[model samples]
Target: MSDKVFNKKIFAYIVAVVLSVFCFLPCLCLVEAEEQPSEAPTVYAADVSVTQGSGTYIYVYAKNFADVSGLDLFVRYDTSAFTLGRATKGSFISSALCDVNAETAGEIRLSYVSVDGVSGDGLILTVLLYSESEAEIKDYKVDIIVGDCYDSGLNSVAVSASGCKITVKEKQQITETVTFYSRYEDVTKRKGDEVALSFYTYNSHGFASADFEINFDDEMLALKSVSLGESLKNTDSATFSVNDKTDGYVKISYAALSAAPSYVTVLEISFTVIGDKDGQTQIEFISSALYNSDLTAYNGSKSIVTVNTEEIPSVIVYPKISLKAHSVTYSEVELDIFAEKDTLLAAGDFFVEFNAEEYECVDIVKIFDGSMIVGNTAFKAGMARLSFIYEDGISGDTAIARLRFKVLAPCETKSEFSISGSKITDKDFNEQIVEYVGTTIVVPHDFSNEFTTDEQPTCDTSGSKSHHCSRCAAVKDVTEIDALGHEYIHHEAKAPTCVEIGWKAYDTCSRCNYTTYEEIKAKGHTKAVAVEENRIEATCLEKGQYDSVVYCSVCNEELSREKKIIEALGHDYIHHKAKAPTCVEIGWEAYDTCSRCDYTTYKEISEKGHTKAAAVEENKIEATCLEDGHYDSVIYCSVCNEELSREEKTIEALGHEYGEWIVDLEPTVSAEGREYRKCLRCEHREERSVEKLKNDDEELSGCFGTLDLTSIVMIVAIMLICGVFVKVKSRKSNR
Candidate 1:
């Protein structure tokens, strides 16, 4: 028991067993920890490879999510081998609410949603795969099916699908094979012929290069040169190019450092046939290129060639004219002669020329269907000589003669039905092929009576004359002229003043300057005689105006009169009655003095004294307990300063006024004589009584005093041993 108190009581029982197992093992591991259930949203997909006709992109993903707010998959694919272009919407649903449906071409029904809730793990849809140019290259799986999955607290989101593998590749096969031909399919040139046209090709795969573009019919052939054909002329390493041969296209190019002949003959072209009415020249192969010696791209076939051209036997005769209006300006024109014969005319002779300053060959008939017969008929200057004889052998169409012309002015001519010395005697009389379709008879220049002198017959008004018909604008000679009388002049006569009215001789019309207004009769105001006088003086209150300056008894002129104010003798006012000013006053004014003319009016006299001021408080002094009182400050004349008005009088003060001493009650010890004192300026009170504080434990402070219980049990066992020695020194410094 004495080995230092047995090791301080065995270290206080090992410091209370290590503070009671450190507060009970963290409350028993938080009551057996447990909480880990979440990790449920899956949705994957991703696979694609595409090539047959290429295009690919496949995503889906959405891994361990949380607030995913909706997604409904169902993919499938292989719709005969993929082809579903466009689904897109990934970034984890930034505003989703999608819904795609490939309409059953192998199933593709997707649905997505996110009305604000899409937590974690990205990408939810991308799709778009294509591969089907005839598809069938391989692999192709793509199968993902979920149905409905959600989160944002609407729970139920536990889906896990995955499938994708497109693959499909095989797409690239051109194999080359071009062809375009024309070795004369149907050509037949004649009109100044020159034709050549070759253009042939057939390449299965041997082409190093080839490019051509040919098009014809530039107005029936013209492009005359473009060689290089003997299968590219021995292939001298074959390199040819030609571009500038344009009338309607021709561009060729050939390149072959080696292989180039699967049957070739590129181009020969060479055209001429310069059109003359017989047409046909189509040869087209506009743009063709076959290159495949490693420069891949060969697929062709184009050939169209046509050439024709041969007619030329002329026998045209024309002049079957008709004209109602060709911008009319003609005086006369008539022509008729028709004979476009391919053969069958027995006899003929022709002559027609015109424009002798615009025509003059009048009449030359012979057309009764009587089979032509109008012999010698000659004219000189404007030329016209006809001698026809058809002796009844005229086949088909006929109307062989009729000519009449006569227009000599307002001319705009073009008459030259020319046919000089022509002869046609077919029917085996041999000498036909007569071509003469000549005719130029334009007669337009008649302007019907173009007289124009619009209006010029002026002497007193009435003129109009016109004529306009440049070509049917028809309007001829509109005339009207009559009125030329009145040229009398005389002006100057004005005499009548007194109140005016006079004019008896005035006439002026030097050709419509028209003037005449005669009247003479007002002379009745002639009794004025006050040469100059303006007296406007009537005083005291206005009523004056007399201005006069008369002098026109018979026109002596000088008038300005304003009389009739004579009754204004009304201001004889001599008023003088007014005097009102009181209250300590000084007033007087009310005047009017214009007995006849001095004119005077006045009013202004006011000064009625004494206004405001009545304050008279005499000296008053009454506040005593210690001085502070005053009154006296006089001011008189509210109208006269009534009675008491002192300026000095209050002076009194004599009573208690003391301060400093503020403790009212503070005294104790057995209350022998409670003290009191007061008077800090009239709050005076005083009561005195002291002496009674001496208790020497009077009988041990009696009150039936008795028990000491062993000194209160020694101060309650010394405060319970000092609170157990300060909680055992705070658990030995917390162990």
Candidate 2:
């Protein structure tokens, strides 16, 4: 009842009141937040259509999605209507960790979370539904309902989800007919002659892939070459392959991303007649399949072609030479010169003419020589003359020269190229026949506008993508995608333990292998005790051990760890099979890893040396009267067919032996007459001019006899006029 006691009571009362008010304020604020009107995030399911027995995607979009760290959603569908294939996360929450569960028959639950809250308004999820193969074609309803949702602060968030309708329709039937046929004119071919045939597809209905297997009489025909046509190599993802390892059969497969036309030439094949006698062989299509863009097989018919062989008067068929030019880049074109396989050429001269206004020659590389031959090329305004000579006669089935050009104009511009003046000769300088085919150079801008990604960009590295040509699958317009910088989160460090080392606090990227860490030394044990665990008994072929551990008496933490060994029971030796060494691979003696541990010892056998075949002549050049001959006699490995050694030897030329000069034309007073002597070994000739019979002094002295001054002046004037007329005529002809 004293004054001091009253004061103490008043202070205690005031402290209690302050505590009560502080606690009530939080409750009041939370209640207000829960009651406050807010626009709830909307989850909308988009209406979709599906084909009966096929699958379709039902997109779930978000409209008012805002700052959220976690979400849970459930989608319910009628079990009898359709089944769920899968639920995939959309780009809206791609950076977050997501989980989908469809354990229940009629419901699917999708849950997602992120440490850093996600905020966006776009597609949220995709649900795939597949109708039963026997399900009736009708409309079905789907309800997308929201479950638990939370914000970054762990506060409850309101989310509203809507329902969608799915309409299932009957699959459409294809009525178009696809046909496969061979195109070849039945021609009479002799043994060793080449027969060409092509296979085509009609009414393909925009097919994506084709496979064909062809059979022929192996004894009568030999497969020479197979080439894919434009339709097979014209897409960004095109692939073509051929398997002809087995005799009498060849299988060709072609695929492209882009759809092909109704009629397309698929492939061309060449064969050599090899039958001993005159006979006929049928190239039959054993099996054919054409797949449309949707991977549905199209009904097709097989085809066959016949080739007849006969003996006739031998006729020499000249090799056909061709020139091809194609754009390699947006600003570069590659020109290649090719000849048929049977062209045995020693020297040749040819010219390639093009429009100088549209393209400019940049470089020319001959494939046969290591270095360009001096003075071998003569470049004029619009033409380039290419001449080459191989001391050793060369046979060709490949490109002889590759020329690079800079496109001076737009890629769409076209320029014509003409090949002419080709004089090919044998080593003996005999004129050999060759047929030249002309071609045009068109730099096409057929690259597709849509780019295909070649490499996807990672968190720290850039990626590349390109637009590919629609007709040749050539890559162009390459672009680099920027790297997505890493998203990092802090990770706390663990304290060093008595038996384990620790690391300092660091940050780690969520998307990539990027981290920063520093190790901390382990704290050694202060107090100790010893114990044993996991004891194992030794076996007939194995050793065993038990874990020996030490513990700190203060914290009961493990201080030291080791294994106490038990002696092994002697092994019962087992023999292993030995393998012989091959020409390239080394062999090993019998060895084995012990049954209890990885322990083995063996001797390595040296690789067997190459089995060399006898040396044979290669790249031989016949000796000529004027040029030296050269050849390389090489030994090859019989097992691997690799060249083992080469001995290059030169053969001296046989010098020309000329006979005595013969007077073919006697000297005349008006002009000089020539005579020649020819070499005895080859058609080598030497000629010298004979001086005009010394304008016989008697005839020359009186050549201009008894002429008046007027006549002499007239004669001089006539000679001047004639000289002038000749010069003028020459100039006109040149122009």
Candidate 3:
């Protein structure tokens, strides 16, 4: 072909392509520019009422949510009337990457992002608040402020935010009886011994103001000093005045900025024994006035303290039972019991009590190796008993036994062990004075609520995660995740032809290197259509011989060769003109042939097979969750440039692996619950209904007294908030 003609054809092709593109692009643009009808997302909170001294959860919901991928939301509420508790991610954002901050007073900030945007309506956040008992009965607002939100394209999404009102109702008042009393029993002290007595006040309603006047026998007991106790821990203003001029009275005026403890030590008074002879005197609270935060007077009692003066004993020896920690761990604890006596030679019996709910008794080994020896060691429920006798005597601090206990509640907890029903006898079998002291063991923090992934699993390597205590941040549980084996992709092999070398089929890892193969073998030449090479015709005049070669059609390689003889004949020559070569076929110069004889050779015209081919995709199908799909890579033929499709491949489907159930709606006394469990692989949800609420009056155990249906339901709602949702890392795949 002429260069000019080729240039013209190429120019025409360019113009056609440009025109086609111009014609089609505008229609696509028009379709893309057409907007879909949708409303802006609305974020709102729910109106709720809570009883005083109780807690309730506030939910932030989203409506008309469309194509929303991420949000940075803020909520504000009054902190004066309520204290914040746990702030958690709701079901709508359960699988989304989220961060929650409730550390700031009166404000909560939540940030969430999803790879595939969420739509429709659901809960986004849940916050807990405890209403102060002393807070005024009024309404409060929880507001959703303006925040940043975005769509899957990272374009800003306009969000309409609204807030809700919370009403705090007055709790039903239970009459609380407050008593001011001296808890001291009648005490005997030697002359000149200082008499110190403590007075406590018990007010279930919790007082903020109090005034007390105490009168002692001033003639026999001289007033020394007065000190405030734990009840005044919150006292913003307090005035204590001694009325020595009035002979026997002391005035204590107390006021607190906050409600004081319900049960606490109020005051301690010390007096000097001034009576010349042996006698008894009374230190009594003559009058008292106490008011709660509401200024309601607390019922009071006038209790007296009696001090008896007695001569010191000639031989004062006090038998003592003491406790010392022997060993302590996260799972077990041991305490050593000891006996101390000033006078030697004695037999004794001891009883110990512990909180059964916090610990379990494992073993008690007697440590006292003495004459006669110990007897009757027994334990039950919350108590342990041990008795021992002496043939001669044992005294002066001797270890009695080692008490071993298994920790039941391992989280940071306190267990108290008390000694009771203990008695010691002298060698003569005479009862002796004794004092028993109890001890408390506080366990270190252990695993409870939250878990963190320490290492992520790979295709070949395992991972580890640990559960930590919610309160103390101590690791209590450690777990290992199994390794995921290699995901393999099957690679089809290219078969060898008569002349071409071929590759052997092998599998390769999509995740990790599990198996490998690179071996290839040569095929024993399978014959294709054979082509004759270097052939000559027989002539008439002379005997003609030619070498005949057979070439492989598949790879154009010489396969076989043979020499053949032909009969010669006289030449009858004919002349042919030469032809020029063109792109479509080959041409040769002029040649001659004989008429009626095979004498002259004639030039032949030939065409060649195609040398290059570009691969094209055909019959493509995308893989789905339930079925496998495949596509083919079709390459062109060398000779005709027609498609010779090869290398068909398949994509495996992903099966569903579901996670734990997520509670969307909690069961109530009046309504059934709805929940859904999602597949971990694809985020597909399977929803189901839960059983209706049962009579759970027993579960309603708390400090809150008799409550109405609304308050009761609020309590139940908080209790039913289970920790079943597994917090996962950010997912990158789109659904």
Candidate 4:
């Protein structure tokens, strides 16, 4: 109230604070448009570009090594196609790089990453490189491959941009001259300079035809020669000369006579040499039938063979080629061709002539009443059917020549062919089928198979993986190798050979496989025989035995037993009286097991201690026959063929003595193994004894018993049957 009423109450509180800030400024602009709306998209930052991976060991992987922090990229080129390398704070991107953009040549390689993508807030780029302008500072060397911070957090990011082209990081050579302003009638003979014209070239594979000698680009206009046409290895050619006093971009003097020469392939030839009806200049030949000497440029389609020194001989027709067989009977038929050599000419044989007329009389004849083997004649095996005639020779247009042939059958078909029938030359049945294995080897037609873990044991590959199939079955859908095997064969013994029978044949790899091999192969003919020596011998052909193999004259070994004995058994009279084992005389029988105490002495062990009758095989138990060491169940008496002995006493040598006689022998314990008791005589009790023998050698004895125990038991059974129990067996290495 003092400074003018306090300035009117401070202007009335500043007009009530400007009417309360313009009444809340439209409710604060509707709450700031409901708090920050619109303007969003463009947030694709999970990698935008990066793809570099090429050859000779250049690798750089990145998916989540923290999105490569400040990951940069620079790469520059336009000096031609790539140069400037090395990075890592040397300023571009780094951590991986090599032999890259080696440096300038027609380059245009440019890879700048001033800021690639990858959001979720993780991306820092600052790479730059400008080419051909904007300060011409092409930067390079930055192989920055980075992504996957958990794959940039699922927002999806796969940055890749390494594609490269024009990759010949090595070649660059430049040579110019390609001139020859069309002129060659220099048929020389000149009088003093300036009229030189030589010219050359007639190529279409005919290589060199040199002549060249024509100049002048503008003195009087002359620029139509560019043919250095041939001599190559990567390629090169020549012919040039400009400055005829200028003014002839004769198409830039014919593109500087095929500009800068050396880039071969794409040679163009233009012509206009006419001197007779107003030479209207119209000759163009630009080479591209893939221009001979092997490619470098003629990028497809451009051969124009048109040189009509006035449309001469383009009237081709040739046709009328025949070799008909009025009625062919000799089988293999089909050869009908007739050519008049040029009657219109498309009957093939580029340069023709074909014949058969009546061909020389029945050569090796197979019904070919008249035959000169000029092309085809049949009969085969019984000789002559060698017909392979592609004759351009006018052979029999009608006089009857009918030449044609095609037939070749001998099928086992393919995995190198196999169908072996005759029980497969049984080497003991293929060594008993390579010692029992899940064999294989039936590729006789569905051929081509090569995956060798090697195992061909007498082959039976039960439908093949041929057993070693841990998992190898794609033999082209493998349908029929299955007769039943192949799921086992752990098969061992791998290299050099001893035994590895897998027979493994299911190999589609590089094909041509019949696989089925098992080889015990001691092969004298493979005889290990032992099924009772595979009997049924008589060259056994009922498959009973004898698949042919014989060769063991005692281990020269090879005898599944093949017959050869016209009449055997008499090596010195029946294997030397049947006493064998002197080791080799083909006798072999030698018996007697008790050398001393095993008491099996039915002996003839010929060291002769007690010799009697070692003879055998004929004792049908006769009165005079003998084979003394017998035991297959005793039965000796065939009429007086006596062997019942307890020390001979037929009624005491028949001297007859009757009475109560007891020659003491009581040690009986019989069960048929050992029983003996001779209680002598004592029996006739009261049965009419009218004594008609009053003094019959009077010798009736009484009973005295005190050991005469059968002569002390036959001398202790011959001293315990000559005791001995040994088993040495060193055998001197099969002596």
Candidate 5:
């Protein structure tokens, strides 16, 4: 072969070897030119969620050839009903677009010049990408229900890049439905117990509500709760409660499972109750569907129910002891009984009997059993197992049940009075007493034939003028004029003719006049009515004996000051009813009454001060002032700049002299207690400006300015590692 032919053949072989090496390099793999794209960029906002007062930024990134420049940002958010804006840089400037929920809507855009060194973006050709979707909702805490008509998979979000995340930024709230919880109180309740039941019908928008009757059957035996929720999302729960008066069943039927406000979708929820004797004493829950379209509800939409109950029993009592009163009429006896369960219950009755161990006498007396409401009967006298029976309102089924109570003897009280007599000459006493003015005599007994005595009597016997001091000093036989013509003294008063000078017949008295109790007894008068100590001559004539009025010297009218009695005058007793109201009444039939007391009342002396005592003479009051200031606090009489003088002087006023001001007392403590009147005195204390205190504020304990060089270096290191990892992952994914 010739030299030229050999050279051409070798070159062709070399070309083939070079192509094989290039293919093995991996970085120079050939790609189709048709796949290279170049068009004006766009930013598509998938969707988003943000709360008012919160801030977050979204990025729309695009890659281009080395000569290509930046792509600006813009947005349209009025559900596409918004206008677009010219390009601007991709950056935040305040709580603006970055704060997705910044209260400004329509569209959001990130724009910039092809900003290589802030200059290249002027070229204007663009490239674009998209951010997640946008949702601007107020109150961040709103319970939300988002119905997506465009797409379906929010239940589990997927991002374009790893580590990029999406969250339910704001909660959706249901305005149409108001939910609540229910609970059972009985220990017999179990985890799946249908302890109560009721029914409710809801409207299409979840508003109008009406409770109906519960219809029970065999299938839904353990009905936890009737609820509504989304099909895929595992949302929170709704609650329910029971007051026990529930029927054996319930029915829940609504126009639809969920309501419509912005969009319509099905709502779902599950109910869970853990009891089996484990439960909550009270319930806390969100409200359920109640009001109708106009926010109105049915009559019984909200109601309370109560359960009927049975009671336990009382078996036996001990302390086998007895007590005979000092008078055998009253005393106390104690007895014991056994019971189970720490329960509180209603009022009840017991029947008990007592017969003396040896002397079984049937005398009426009261019996007590430590129960204040428990009544005691009157006991004549006796012993022998003061047996009584009682019932308890709290019973048990799975346990042995018993309760305890005690019995006690009771007593009745009676007030006693002793009769007595008094003596003095009414006219004679008046004549002999100037110091005795305004004072009168009081005794415990009454005397008759008091006006018959013409002479003073002694304790011993005297003639008709001289006397046997018993009923009267002396008495006349007015019976001589009677049809029987017998000599017996008559009970009559003497009428004075012309009111001639003093006749010496004076009888009933303890301190002012004289009277024998025997004579008072004969006239059939009680001691209380006849004798009172302070006799006011004015009103005494009306009451006969003065107990309440004071002697009035001017008008001669009775000066009636209030009288002291156990109860108020005209209001010492009251009457009342005994039975409690039942379901038959509209809530309350037993209001407060005092008919049995037989009177209305006034505040007792203890309750109202100054009820009787008169005011004393007033004194002239004075004052002194002093300064009270602290080291740290600043104070000023903002109105009057006048410096106050601090001194203390005792001024007598309102009938009394208040004490002086003591400087030694702690001013801080004193200032807290006394409300100082800002008068001509305290005007000094100056106040400092708040602006001056601002300088004392603390500075943030952090490094400011761009991140430290060290941090930047670390970030760069992390980015490098992540980029390598991503590249490897990409290769694997492609493979």
Candidate 6:
């Protein structure tokens, strides 16, 4: 073979071995890489926005997470703009236990955990933010801070912080105005009289149309008609509508072709005074609306007109007198003389007459605003007269005089002051006609007969009372008051017991034979006693009992006798007297007995006492380097056939007994030294070292040393090749 070919083959084998080793190195490195720990997850905040009075939320996001257990998220925001509400867990942590503290004004914190770990990306928690009413219309900032965050492994999670911006907007607003009024100050009319009221309005902006609703006391006045006022009626194209279908209220609407004047009468309403009793009622404009030409709203004002019934006299011209009548028992009656109108009254004379048997005129005087009067009053029997003259005539309506009368006795009669007979003249000395309305006066007479009693009648007794005249000291009548029956109070009966007697309780009236009670009976004996002394003692192996008796505590009688068994205690053996078996001697028998019954028992004991004789070897053998030696030994009991001890003994090892060392293999120049020896009996061999000739010639040595196995084989193959080559050459020459 060619040398080049052989070298190529060797190079190929080297490359293969190097490649194989290189391949294994990468696999080992990969295993090491796989064993390295993973990085922790990150948590962060997300931005959000909300309007004033609107609700929104912010998110706490977790990224690159794995097996997360719990985390505390702390976030801060502008307290002036935002309010924290409920916090909700994200899907990643939805099933975990959670706690939220958003109650603090601007800060919110949440924590969540799960027994089963949470992992992956997504939100960890979401918190709600509500814009408060006082929140300003501007931007708000929410910032996040790192808190306690952990994974299922209890390792803290790394987190990055970010802030969110919230925008707030203002709310909307609205404003409006309308009004109504009456043309008259107040109207006065008699019952069954009709009156009219005109409603007007004043608006800054001229109005094209107007609508109004007016309400009045339905019991006092009934709406008769409603019509457009003259101001609105002049508009030829104007329209008017009225709704009087509902009692107590009239709704009217007026529209013009163009905007009406700023101040104009919008409606005329007529009503009839229907009720009989005299009263004043309000004609109120409850609601009103004025519209511009384009139908846009315009502001206005509202007003009310008071309507009074004429049954109440007017304070203008007529003079009126009022006398107040009281109970017949009243000591005196007063007459208040007043004028319905303000007038110049120079002089006036008044006279009042009452029943002579019931009352008498006691006094006459002028009351309030009487400084202008110089009067002399006279009263006698049942007639009273008063006259006055004013230095400067009276100008306004006022009380002229006050007359008082004394009650003479108890009587029912009518009395009055007559202005027809009296005289009233003005400063011009002209007579003034006065309208005087009179009232009946009654004076009650004192009664001698009166009912008197000390105590009121009750359900259980009759009470007596007397009727007599206290003033006349006359007994007009005497009678008795009926009695009321007694009301008995009772208690439920109690049941009888072994020692206590039972009874029922009740009450009885003192004035009447109304009695209530309950029966009581003697109680029986309650028995109790100590344990009986007739009980038999229990044996260790058997159970026994005796009758126990109980006696009554109150009667000293036997109540019950019952059997109570005593439990048996097992036998007790004495440990100190126990006999143990020995190697040669026989032990005494063991026995047990009950402590209470004295019953005995016995048990067989094995013999254990024994003494051992000295050991004697029976079989013995010699030992060699390769084989073990042995001997048998035993110790016998001195008093029995039992062997106390036995053993198989070893005679100690006879290690290799080698002869003198001799050279086993002669060392070559490149080889190490070697020598050996053998055991005489076992033929076991041992070796020793011998020195080798050192190699000084470099040309003679192979790669490792002088001709190692591989080099030597290669050299022998070369020699064979050289011989084959010579043979081939010879063969060729012969050819």
* lDDT (C-alpha, whole model) for all candidates: 0.65, 0.76, 0.72, 0.28, 0.29, 0.67
Better of 1 and 4 by TM-score: 1
Candidate with better lDDT, 2 vs 4:
2
Per-residue lDDT of 1-735 in model 1, one digit per residue for the tens? 454684587567556544555556465445534443566667776566765755666777778776778877887777776666556456567577776777777777778777777777877666666677789888877778898787767777677887878788886665555766778746567767787768666644676677677666565677878876776667657778788433456677778766666787777777777786666667676434566667776665567787878766686564221211112236656666666444466676777766677667677778646565564434677677776666655666665677767776453445555755556676456666555555665666444454675676666677666666665555655766665567778877887666778896798877677788787876766656775367776544556666667776787676566564643455566787778776666567877776676767766677666655767666566665657677887766676554434565555655665454444454445556456656556675656666556565755665334534344444554565566566767766776
Candidate 6 backbone overlaps, count: 30
Best TM-score among the predictions, by candidate number: 6
What TM-score fits each model? Answer: 0.21, 0.23, 0.22, 0.12, 0.15, 0.28
lDDT of 1 at 152: 69
Give each prediction's root-mean-square deviation over alpha carbons.
Answer: 43.9, 56.2, 45.2, 53.1, 41.8, 45.8
In model 4, how large is the Cα lDDT of residue 621? 31
Off by over 4 Å in 2: 1-38, 173-735
Stretch of 10 with least lDDT, candidate 1: 319-328
**Local error of candidate 6 at residue 609 (angstroms):** 87
After the best TM-score superposition of candidate 2, give how far the Cα of residue 407 lies from its true spot, in angstroms.
67
Model 6, 56-148: lDDT tens digits are: 667778777677787777878886776664455566666789876777767777777777877788876666676886688887777777687
Judged by whole-model lDDT over C-alpha atoms, candidate 6 comes out at: 0.67
Error of 2 at 492 (Å): 98
- In the range 465-500, model 4's lDDT, one tens digit per residue, is 322222233233333344333334334432222222
- Name the lDDT value of residue 353 in candidate 4: 17
Candidate 4 TM-score versus the reference: 0.12
In angstroms, give how far residue 202 of model 2 lies from its true place: 14
Model 3: per-residue Cα lDDT over 1-735, one tens digit each: 654675566556556655655566666556646754457679998799997766677888989998899999999888889898557677787778989898889999999999999899988887778788787898998888858899999999999999999999987664555777676646677657788888876654677776666666555777788866754754565444444433456667777756777678888878887765577777767433567778876545567777888654467546667788988877888888776745353677777788888887777786767644343334677777766676566656777678788888756687788886545777888776776788989986655566688898888799988987654657746989777667788888877766456777888888766555665555555445544445666556567676777665565577787777778666677898887654357887788877866656667677554554788778999876677889998798665676656889888986777899999999887689999998876678899998877656745553355554445444543343221111111111221
Ranking of all candidate structures by their TM-score, best first? 6, 2, 3, 1, 5, 4
Q: Which should have the higher TM-score, number 1 or number 6?
A: 6
Order the candidate numbers by lDDT, best to worst. Answer: 2, 3, 6, 1, 5, 4
